[model samples]
Target chain A: MRIAYIKNKLLTIDESFVFRVKYQTNNSILSTIESEIDTVLSVEHSEVLGALRNNDLENEAIYIFREVAAQFERPVLLFSGGKDSITLVRLAQKAFFPAKIPFPLLHIDTGHNFPETIAFRDKLVKELGVELIVRNVQDSIDQGKVVEESGKYASRNTLQTTTLLDAIEEFKFDACIGGARRDEEKARAKERVFSVRDDFGQWDEKNQRPEVFDMLNGQIELGQNVRVFPISNWTELDVWSYIQKENIEIPSIYFAHKRKIFLRDGFIWSAEDDVVFRAEDEVVEERMVRFRTVGDMSCTAAVLSEADTIEKVVGEIRESKISERGARIDDKRSEAAMEKRKQQGYF
Target chain B: MEVLKIATAGSVDDGKSTLIGRLLYDTKSLTDDKLEAIEKTSKQKGYDYLDFSLVTDGLVAEREQGITIDVAHIYFSTPNKSYIIADTPGHVEYTRNMVTGASTSQAAIILIDARKGVIEQTNRHFFINNLLRIKDVIVAVNKMDLVDFSEARYQEIKSDFEELMGKRDYQDQKITFIPVSALKGDNVVNRSENMTWYKGQTLLEHFEALDKEDVYNVGTPRFPVQYVIRPKTEEFHDFRGFAGKVYGGELSVGDEVVVLPSMTKSRIKEIYFYDKKYQTATRRSSVTITLEDEVNVSRGDMLVKVGDLPTVNKEFTATISWMDSQNLNLGNKYVLQHGVNKVLAKVENIHHKIEPDYSGVDESVNSLAMNDIALVTFRLNKPIFYDTFKEHRTNGSFILIDNQTNNTAGVGFIE
Candidate 1:
């Protein structure tokens, strides 16, 4: 098909200053131009590219992304070894190429992560040659900054917040890029793309500044850092599609496989070791399973499925009756489990 | 499959929660753990049958009062579509919350108790949905079992709603009527065995058949620059790009573009979605574009083609939905947030307080109270490029923030 291209002359400053100037252009030509430019641009960095490619969310991802990349003296992608964070890493790479990712990668270790996720996290940082800063939740617990919960339903999801806040304070990071999507949780739905946190790292959900067209309000007093979600609008399906389209490498546990798992509180608990408590009433057995979301191994449950391939997994998600959070045991504690955690600075 | 977002509004005891409970129960969307919790909670409260409202009504304050205070998002899916129900409060005090919930929704379900045919709450619910331009609305006259599946009552309420729809600004909205007993699991997820007079699809069946066209899609593309992504790495150190999501339309490379405020002109040099480039970036994709020329641009600036310019002005008229407890009166200064731009604005005129019951406008009103929707005018400190809310949702709408408290006091849909 012949591409319709709109090649108009550039305007001088005094010509016009309106925000949006609509012009007619061929759809095919526009797409062709995008493809042609992508071929020539050398996006060596991984983090920026991950974000850049997963661009099917909010329109401002590309525009504010350029601003954030330029504004900060030092910026970092908070990589969690999760699909969302990994995608941010790739976007950061393409964001700044030739030079390594402009800033270091920070990881807040919960001390209870799946082994494969941790392994993948290390490999990614090593391959990208960017500096890696790891903060431990165990350190926070040991220092009495956070207390460990007792019993079978215990998790370190809330403890990671302390470690994350400490790292930000220690590094004085002005802006921390996150992979949180607004569609994932309700409290997050109320969050701004450029959410401001006080020196104490608390989200003022009620007073968020209105976010309008491509501009992000990055104005904040000193000691107040910003939490920027580049992919705030991307749903679970969009992320998976981008992964499949880019062939981005993920942990093996995401695909279906056979493993020894036990049903406790009606969730598929991995029978890995003593890291997770087991009750005598629960029956343990080996079963074929896969994880939809990768969180703290104790809290993240496995689902019964045969979606071993990316295409199959995407298809399964499209037709699945239950929500992605259905496999999570932690949320079963209460209706506002996620909201309460977010209020206390848990990301 | 497409995603459908619906907002539910009804009276305090109109079985709004029960209707939602029935949907989750009949659809089998409730997981085993969630079901167990509901059963335990319901039994503890000494209910004989499972009180489905226990599944939702999450807030501690709400459970204590047995009422929904805020909007709670509930997710469920059928074979063809995924649904997000914004369960909003029915009380008049929470009318603002209802509007907030319905603002993003494509459809709305206004619940009516079978015993109480059509009440004032129903009018307010319909009014907000109409004001927000929700395209599809379902008037679910709940508790049909109490009325013995009476078709006469259903017709009465449907006719009442038709009278209210006459006052709506948008005439193209499609409104459907359904009668069901939420407690008996009839006509919510499955076709009712009792309502033989009803010929339409069941609630779930009706929802499954809706295409994207039946919903309120995003308006014209509005690209609000969020942040700039510039990685000054050694290999390609000179690369500069603007990053943001496109609100309504697609942007492509090699398009003649103009930057806002500065009005710098440039051609789209490259469009990067990670490493690979595409010909066009569709609505809502966060991509970076490098301009062909080295025009100076920064945050809070917009980029678009040369001919399609929005209205650039410092003042305009708007319809405001007052949210705060404080009154919205003339001469009150507030921060008007238009897209990503914030400008100081003052209330220039207060035309009238729009009665929620679709009654005639009250021109005597001088100020708007909480939950009051009014048509007002404002004067901004600086020129804000915008379009009518109907033309471009992203650029046309705005929020009002009280300068003293910094609270989002009101929302404005451009006139």
Candidate 2:
């Protein structure tokens, strides 16, 4: 492997192409193809290396992804209307261009989402012309599957797990390609790119097998599903970099804007007219803010920031001391909030 | 900015959560809203000192019980590196959670109470770090004020830990000790005058000194085929691509490669990162590659360079960390997931149970229990391509899922 990389570098410097052939004579399908390559003397295809120093990172990901897409009968792209997922969509499109996305896109709606995020999600799905399956918390509540709690602190963050599981079962999606980045949470940091979920969608954190290198084991029986995160190794900065480079379109709520908000816990709670259970004693006022994360509006709090553009937002986040989830009220509800939700199948 | 994955482990009441909260607070990682929430909750609960545990203990049951139940991933960042700290439960019963947290981290922070010095939890914390082969271990002797800022006590604890270090097999690991108070402003991010006797760097200063090379250099490269993208369109006519993350090493266009299981040989025709092409694909970066020939490669099949062949065997020995309630017995069938491939495996035999307290092995143990770490052997229905966990961390480990419950029951490091 080292020699091949060196040869490629040398070829670039010398501008002289030298192809390496497998020396092994094993009587297998791979050896037969190698012999054919040796007969040709020289092999050629699209060999343009990325300008970025980190080209090697992108190239290997593309290769592994194509391999997994071919093996699964039904694989669904887990679209969350997030920047990371947007990058996955673009990468997936390039993976199989002109053929259209082979799988459907799945979204588990919390019913407490920001209007702008919902609008953008619908627009992207329409433009892509791909199948979109949205499972709702409202449906779950209507069926008495998950009760809707009322009050100023009410949130549907945990209920999304049940809706997501229901959607997977309804579609029989064996593979779910998510946009979850390992850098976001500790539970997520331990997650595999191809994490196995039982029929109930529980993630067994303690017994997770170490995912070495790029080999994603996609072996599971019927009724079992695998959550595939292509950007498992990507950090928040990486996602921001990709968004900036790709010039990807995001919801306006990510940018700075003035809105009627109240300070309940230091976070700016949007005093939107549609929101329910707002205490009269809670004071509401306008504030300059933008959301660091876009989740269920009731649970997702906005940060005070003047960084309207992507560049400034990235710059601000770089120097900021607090974490993205620090403003997330749902997680602030308790210490083990994320772990408890994950045990019950929360993504 | 690069994202750094880290994990924190310690015994119960080591103020692991407090230390984490302090880090976030001192770094200004907490937003104004979060601070207010903490204050309101603290006032409501009638606690004098703000409870940082509330920030990490996300579950109601955990907050009520005043302990962490499982793993909670907390994200914070400096301009240099964005950090994700997996705060795992410290109770002895949740050993599996500690393993889970440390598995993905490049760095680990093991907390030790200065008052109690090194205790049983310290051994478990160090054991998990060594087993996971985490390159960097930060031993933060927290609650320095409780020990009266005693330099002698700090030195004693440090020497005691150095003795325990004798047992670790991975010598490349670097260990650093720092004394700090999580409650008051101390040597976490800022150097402390309280510890005038000590002259080492602060916790954050030490973190700033970490180089990128020390973080990601795990082991050999292993590329497990994720999905195959074949855009057999009219314009391109034929584009057969293999998509996956590059592990261990990089793959370039025109590299001699062998498709595993089938053993079909081919050269990397092209490497694509989105629309652009790349000369090589580095480890951990996800990309697609088209082969020179139209060879058949599918998911679960690996594409590795011929010279660096991993172990392709039907049976092997491994250290099994049992994580479920049901006892692991011989003849039990389980689905063994190794890398991106899975094979039907059965428990062949139990070699012996290694006691958790760094004692001698239990040779006569019949079954393994929850939080039990033991050596065992297995027989696979089909040959699994693997490597010794020490040689290649990515290719050398696997997890066993119980056939009956579909629960991940055991994690195995290939021997």
Candidate 3:
């Protein structure tokens, strides 16, 4: 029990102290002293209750970022200009403050991203004074490394994995720090903080090194890379709370605005842009919408919301009935869509 | 809000996944889309009841096999606090998965099938929880509907578990028992009216009543330097900060500190969480510190209070949990990573292998195979500051990286 002092004179005891005395067979002396300290105890109890809690998750993430810096030869932060990645950048900054972030940033562009997201990406990198490496899925397609899909429900989401692999090989990066939270998808729920990838960038779910306590093992062989998710334990609300608390800047597309979108299979697809495939019968209509998650325009869905501010967006997320990934069209492809993609080295 | 991480362990047929799914469903943590998917799959599977395992069995292979293959983390929050549950497998890769899951958890839930009573698998679950030194243990006697929710059956299992508890070396563990029907959703989140005699708090109530401080072990402060932040810029040209996380206890400015490996003494000039300077750095907080005197402190060097020092030694004995397929033999070298410090370690001797069922220790062990837990001595190339696992968990534990494979082959809890 913590002994709380009042004005450095009075000694205060909480309810647990009294309960312990009462449970004793004979404690007449203790009871007498408890009565004198009862009033002071109540005052201290409220103070303890109202104490500002420390952000342990933030501390943990900073530790992980430091480990990646110290353990790997070349580490890069995989930025998607999304809220989670934005939070990761702030954490990285906090990890090595008073000094520039040691690593660069990598963005695997699917070439179908929101223009606002692309704009935000460039601004954040410049503000941080960090190098940004952008690789396009179109480049992979043009080089015949990956084939583009062409169907009503086709998306370039799966094609980013090839480009990401090419970039990793090109840079010879030993570690890729990503913002893949466990709360986003089920396959991610089983992910390790320091997930090891084979030469082909495949994740062996069956055989994974057991991580115990704060000791994260980052040792890996040559030609193998580790995918480090520092915020693997954070949830969607935690991210929003962090953004609101830290006052981090994000892309404007996250807020609610009037946009031309079409309805298909109970999903709202952006129609103002020609990036997404639209059928002849699929009609376009304007709706006040915002994206819960940012990805390829063809794969990302928007919800009917009026949250134009960060605070309002947080409230909307708190009261939301649907999961954040519900807006992700790629996950709806199959029950094992994420697992299959992850095995193929999807960030 | 405080976050309480829990690890749940059960045999293949003990309804472990069902309990987690039920807990999420009853608490309304499962979103509408997730519920719909579960409903759709349950209907297609032609089951009268919902296949709760579908909510946690994320992999297609796991779904096809109807078992958990890895530890899947699940998150839920109430107004008071937040919870992170590590749902791990028990049958296939028991030790590796169970130890991995329980390592970071402050509490654990060991599920027992009411019909099957106390089994060997139950002993393994209790053993790992004890080995990992989990502070709180909840013995959930599940499938109460099948046992008629009988008090006699519950007490019988509790008594059996108590016998196993008596065999454990670490006796400070707090244990609680709850009778639940995970499939029927009784006594998991809500009280069970079927068993009116049982007056203990429900599983959810147990979590709600727990204080965060009680779950965490308080010990001496040990700061292992992770990085050194030096701007070398004109504005703060002479700024030198030792960046690290404070473990076990708090460190305040002006406190006398000693740098490890080279016992140079210095006082804390400032504690910076970020930009703002704090008078004190709380436990588990990642903060950068500027010393009053320039000390040769770098990554892998620890900073401790002048009077409170850890054992700086070149060799020690530890209880090892082997995770690799190859056997751990005498003279086998590994990269021993303790906190941020990495040193080359060679296995000196395999003392004995302890049985997970609390049967006894076998002193005749020559080599440690996969999933083997044994007492072994390791000699390090250089000195490492450590404490007994019982004294300070973070400072006392270490991981062994296989030199050839470069894999985390085993974990050690210093004795």
Candidate 4:
């Protein structure tokens, strides 16, 4: 037996003399051009193969999204116009591709949101053609459901819970999908992927149902709804990496830009919006900064950075010595701030 | 990057939280602000060293009680792999939390205090891991600093644990032992200088060296339809795809498949993961698959390779880990959730209870209480496609939900 090497392609032949004669009769120039084309095809093929390797975080999130659709009749995505919520929207889209996102988005607005975030949220909702429902904390305040806190560190972040619960009751939503990652806060670390809330929307952190394997128990009472966190296993770094890989669009506040800011309690507070309360002695300065997280503008802090692009933002997050929630002033209020807020129905 | 899920189990004061904090701290996974808070809290409490347990005891009640009541998930990553550790408490509903934590994990770490080596809690932890069929297990003998970092002490604990290992029915489990002081950070992320007598790899090194490919048992591919994606748009007017996550094994484009329950046969036309079409959908990848022929498939239906069909049955016996406060008695009815599918099931019989301390099963046991592991038979309202727990983990398990309260009452592994 003999082997014929035909322009980088290997073929076996039994007769060596016949193989040599066949090779001479073949067009060498055409074979060379064909081999060059094969090289290009292989390169493109690997790129596709690379994408075939799905990120576990993305897959699990999408699976949870599908579960929500299958389990509940009235499900809603709790969109905050943040990167995490934006990522959730994309995952929801992917979960049911070619089809529109099966559920509408519910946004519990504090009315103290970054203008850029609101603009971005409206634009995304229009592009995706998904219904957007906005509930205002100001309405809750007006209805005497919640009282506005007035102080130097006062924020409307905690008051959003009342409005959120009201919205849940109004829509009778059985599942509210949100992008609450476990790695964000300690209280969140103990949350189940399909967390069940009572009729009053209270999170029973201590007595959570056991979630075994990939089995999610979405069973609930008539008035109770489950708070579904698809990205419960995802970390901040994973979210940023996924954003960069998918080239997902986020709020402009996430990227570095010239902004008027002030320092308070060792954190940079954006002064571009009048939502954030400032002291009389506080001095404002112009700095290139980006928000590591997007919450109510009153409580969310900015980090000084030059990461204007998604790639640069991811790179900065990888090397940064601070956690994503470190800039969240609301969490800094008390030790169990997140837990306290979550118990009151805050997503 | 690949993700590695792990569960930590030990008795109270076994330093499970400390070990997790040490892993996060040594890997530089903890941010500067978190460290500062830990330091500030530790000093305020008049502790000589920083109390790393504060990092995981998140709930106010847990902090007040100084004991973990619920499982807390901690995340850390090396350059190669990311780790998610479910730190569970070892008291009260120990078995319930341990089972909950270990169910999603590929590996588990059972911590043993060097001074109190291989106690009853250690036995229970090992028993749960064995029952869950977790492949990789690391038995870390913590508080080695208190034991003078004695190799002899470590060996004594290792041999005692080995004795327990002999009693385990699941022999495929791979167990590794390491001596460490999670407080002083020895033999955890870095090699221990105090225990130079032990020449094995550190806990982190051993985990890093593990073959990530064998984490989940690879069985025949089973695609449980989660949702139906029918765009009904102008471009994709007739497009009807069954969206699901492929479990166990890879599913190819042209593979002959049979829809479960209905038993409809069809060939896969295409496998779509988001926008791009793939020739094959690998295990655990959520993809939408279109069949060559339109099949009346809906949620709760499963797609499996022809000739690789699972057992379809309306009644089965399973080992149940009851987690509810109410006693699980025979003749009781509950909602049985198998993956995304739910069916009403009645407790036909209570066979026996297996003690978690390596003792033999109690044949005369009648009912199961909280944290009780027992064998029970259930008759479902409808037949479900299933597999044995030893063969396919995901398909082999189900959760019992209380019909009235909707609480997850128990978790069952099919026999």
Candidate 5:
């Protein structure tokens, strides 16, 4: 044990070089040309279009899903009406395929959610036949656990953390899987796959467990839990492409639709509902707008689009220059708004 | 398209973040909103050039100090492939962060300041890449414009690095050298006009031509059971599938298998990747495997072909990279996690600490501090089936957790 990496005796010849060795030994396995071809075939075996395309991400995601099932006593998926969470449900289904998804679905409904999104969420849950636990921000407000903010720039987005933490405590969920991709925001870029949270659900950004290989450390104490992000590597385009490839159903708000909207601070706000804080001077108008991220109505801003179908939506996403997080008004409050929110355990 | 994960290393002021930002900028990966934000921040900071570091240094303290504090992952793509760059801080204090960044990375870019030539930081960076066994390494000699795009300076640095590369055990690693200025955007995505004497593919070109097969190793198949799917539903009453991801080689439907610890033999009854059944489970594919016999198998139990058994031992020697504030001394107990398996382990003996600069090893050290890399032996409460790190990447590695703090204290590669 008293040594370094170089202290190893040169590796023995017990590796797959055995194929070449077999080729040398009487060539019984193949003809010279075939064996030469066999070596290349053995090296790659024509990777079935890719493990990189979506297969690798899909496989890696499924791996995380199973880890949560095995390592944690109780795990629940944080499903919103967004395409990312919807994709997570599909991955979870495949991870356990033929077997019902082991965990329940938790939606921290801000209560300001779009009517269409809530409808979509219920339908998907019904279709999956999994238990749905809906905890409301309105309930938190009613219970005096949180106070709703006022003013034009205010949103119920930050209040969801209180409800989320409460729900985690109530359910005693040791693992809460979310569809957080690293590409979404700057602070999220440094987050680990199996992110550990304290009893308060606070994230210690300065100190996180180092993840390596395909290994994830799910070890934690009694009061602490892990936030698992299976698709942390997937980009927004990758999500859409996967949805397109798998033909997974999503909330109708993602595609183009006519909606009453108002313009504020270079953002498109849905004027159909009075949930969002809007000034009187802000004139309402009709636009073919689609929601880029399906947060609650108060925070989520729609993107102007004419892409009604999935193919067109995928194409639009590929061509869209602005990031998905750019459309979320909650993030516009400050540069470190997400960091602060995450430190307080906002998923 | 393939996704290439790359790690970047450079000392403070070496422009590692700047190089990553330049890559994203040249690839048109930065959205207009992000660019506008950078412009606004740069203006307020009174900088003539865009402060690209603002894009990656996400934490408040990092921005205040104007230095990267941890590993930040940045995503971009070319027409050929998608790329994820893990930007790691290069200061000696962030050795653990750099090692963590390099562990998941398939390739690494060791940034060398052109004017400074090969420094001590370069040696550590290269040493980390070698320790992690990164298959492909690109030594980008940054800030060539400041040296008047001198080929002589780049060559001098390249030769020095090549000399250091001789000390690594991963002799099969591919190393390429390129000269560029990250701020001026030279040889990162496109060839630099300042260095006409240097004739080679740009840094992007080298990556585009990199095949995924070359980055990952394919070896004998090893499947570590993560969970057992027992669907007692009436539709499949007898259905009991071993859910796990296949590593190394392929596992066919009829392949005879052995469950670890149980030593029970069974034949694969079926292989399912999602709903569809396949004859073979290719390497790295997550699938549900059903055995012909109903032998006892649970999470943490490994399934492999009978002839390809790994080393099952309660005691083993390993190289550990300690990452904790508390010192790791002899007889310290930890929760040793080897793949899906967890076993209580106590340090049997302390070995020599290996310096990342490849200088030498300290044989007399009995304790490991933060960021200390050493070879130590451990005695486990139960035997874990494992492989040499040189043979299998996933099966050969494990992490140590101090039960008191629940902090991942150290990571080890089996010897």
Candidate 6:
């Protein structure tokens, strides 16, 4: 099908361009023949007829990105070097094709991230020609803003909130776009697409603003900002499928590789990093495993898999019986772990 | 694969959660660890059967209280389509939450306990679904096993629901009646041998056989420009495109379009989706379009076909659903958001409060409190181009944000 502007009117033509000829001829028989031909052509290409197809998730994300750009003066993307955030980066790129991504990526590094993830993050930023802003939880701890947790289950994951809030204040970002999906955790399921945060960066779960239809209310006070999750409607499989469809580059840890690991609480702990605390009795061994979720080395666990390629990884996720957040040790702490963290502005 | 969003509504103990869990379980969408957790929790609680509510009730308070407090999104996909079910709390107090869940959904499932038949809660659920113009509604008469799987009882409830359907304003809605026991695994994903007298599609079969294209492909094309994409780079110095998602219908290149608020006429020069350009833009697809001439187009401005212009006015009547704790009285000001456009608006008059249970309207009501639905008139500071809610879902609906707290106070559907 083809559309053209002729005589100041929109006209659609099929493969034969019979409509144009029929219009020129002004014959009733020719018009009937043209209609018949159009019907046949439409039926033949019915499967691929629609202009949208099944790209609702991507389209919604792109629309949210544009809304953030239009509504807020200064907006920044919260990049965690994870698959969800990486998908957000690509969506932002698609939102404005010829134009560069309007906002810079804000990475609140826990200082316990994998070296491979950091390298991947830097490379992605350089290739996209977008600015990268890094803030460290250690800096916040050194500044006496937040205290580091001690003992066995200590993770810098919660401490990163302080650094993130500080960076938001420093940059005065009115909107912080994150790649949090609703299907990840229970508390996240109740999140709105355009979530509002107060001056203290607190999320009011019970008294959330009602978001109706596609109209997003981004109205906020001077000190307050909105945490926009474009992919809130997307699930884990959707992200993997989108990544596979786009052929986007990701960290090597996502694929199966030989890594030194130890088992703790039925989870495979990466022994390659000193950030993960292991008891003396916990013997290290080599295993063919891959990371299902990318978080701080202390929290994220590896699943036993041989899915070495994107297609294989997507297939593994499709067939696997474990939820994505099941691999994240933070959620296993309590039933309300995600909700409590979210109320404290932990994105 | 296509994603179908569904909202489930039922009062407490109606087995709504179990029905959802059954759908997930039968489809093999629930992961092993999640199922194990549910099983462990169920066993610890010393229940004879697995409490499927544990799968959706995520909050600690909810678990302790044994009730859903808010809407919880549960995802599961079959080979044909991906499904996102908004598990809304079925309570008299959380009517606003139910509406919130149904607003974005294309379909809804109203669970009716077979023993109780169609109660007042069922009336409210059906009324809300009609108000939201949800296309597909499945009235699942659950707990059929408890009622001995009697086809007579199912027919009785179906007729009761059909009587309530007469009170609905929107007659175009399609409501299907199904008999199923959410807990007994009967007529949910598989046909029930006990209810041999009944012959109908199972819950999963009904969903699979739905015409997905007819769900959201109606109404006139309405494109509300979200943002203006301007690439002032060295290569493309003067590229300015209007970016937004197309709602209702398709828009093609060379369409004589008019920019709203400005009423400036222009033709669509190009329709670009990311790096590729298309001759036509389909409904629900987000694309950037460049006009033939450089018009003063900005965010919140709408691009529509010249012949199909919406009502441009400053004052209008709407059916408002109040959501905030504070009451909405006459003369109260709010930031009215219509699509991407924002304007200050004040309540001009309070018409009447419409009861959700198909009861008559109350005219003596002067103010609307929480969970109240009423017809109200609003005078906008600036004129907005809008259509009736029934005519254009996206163009006609709006949200009222409180000026002081910035909380979404009410949602209005234009009359």
lDDT of 5 by residue, A1-347 (tens): 32222122212222234333532453323334333543443344332211111267888899999999988999999998889999999999999978899999999998888888899989988998999999999999999989989888778899999999999999999999999999999999999999999999999999888787777888788989999999999999889878876778888888899999999888999998989888889999999989888887888888999999887787788778999999998888899999999999999
Where does model 3 sit among the CAPRI classes? acceptable
TM-score of decoy 4: 0.93
| Predicted candidate 1 versus true structure: per-residue lDDT over B252-338, tens digit per residue | 777888888777788877776655556676666766677899988765678877887778888899888898888988899988877
The clash number for model 2 is: 66
Q: Per-prediction TM-score, please?
A: 0.80, 0.80, 0.93, 0.93, 0.92, 0.92
Over B1-415, each residue of candidate 2 has an lDDT whose tens digit, in order, gives 3446678998889899998899888888776656777898899999999988767775555667888877777766664455778888889898888887788788999999999988988998898899888998999999999989889999999999999999887888999999999888589888898999889998888876776677766565667876666666677678877766677777777888888988888888887766667777766776667899989988678988878788889999999788888999878889888866778999989999978786668898878999999989999999988889888777888888777766677788988
Q: Taking the tens digit of each residue's C-alpha lDDT, what string does model 4 give over B1-415?
A: 5788999998999898899989988988889999999999999999999899989998999899998888899998876677899888898466899999999999999999999998888889999999999999999999999999998999999999999998887999999999999999998998898998989889999888766555778899999999899999999999999999999999988899999999999999988888767777878999999999989999999999999999999999999899999999888999898977888999888888986555878888778899999989999999999999999999999999998888999999999
DockQ of 1: 0.17
TM-score of chain A of 3: 0.85
Superior by DockQ: candidate 2 or candidate 5: 5
DockQ of 3: 0.33
lDDT of 4 by residue, A179-244 (tens): 999999999999999999999899888788888889888888799999999999998988987786
Write one digit per residue (lDDT tens) for candidate 6, span B1-415: 4778899999999999899889888888888888888898899999989888888887777888999988889988776677899889889888899989999899999999999999999988998899999989999999999999998899999888888988789898989998999998898899988888878899989987776554663888989988888899898789999999998888988899999989999999888888766768978899999999999998889999989999999999999889999999989899999998989999999999986565799888888999999999999999999999999888889999988988888898999
lDDT of 5 by residue, B148-257 (tens): 98988888888988899889978989999999999999999988888998899889999988876779988789999999998888998989999998988888878999
How well does candidate 6 reproduce the true complex, by DockQ? Answer: 0.34
Please estimate how well model 3 matches the true structure, expressed as its whole-model Cα lDDT: 0.88
- Model 6 C-alpha lDDT per residue in residues A238-298, reported as the tens digit of each score: 8997787677899999999999999999999999999899999999999999998889999
Residue-level lDDT tens digits of model 2 in A1-347: 64455445544431001111111222134334434542332234333643224433234344445645754678998777867677788767766654577888888887777888889989998888799988898999999998887888888877888788988888898888877776565446456667778878887764554343334456577888888877666666567655654567988888899988887766678888465346789898888899878877887788898988876776676566566777777776665567667777777
What level of docking quality does candidate 5 show?
acceptable
Give the interface RMSD of candidate 3. Answer: 6.5
Candidate 6 has an fnat equal to 0.65
lDDT of 5 at A102: 95
List, residue by residue over A1-347, the lDDT tens digit for candidate 1: 11112111111211111101211233234334444543433342222221222222323344445556655665667888888888777666655443366678888888888889999998998899989999998999999999998888888887788898899889998888888875565455555677777888887564455443343556566787778888775667667756765568998889999988898766788897566778887788999899988888878888898989887777776556566677877776776787677666667
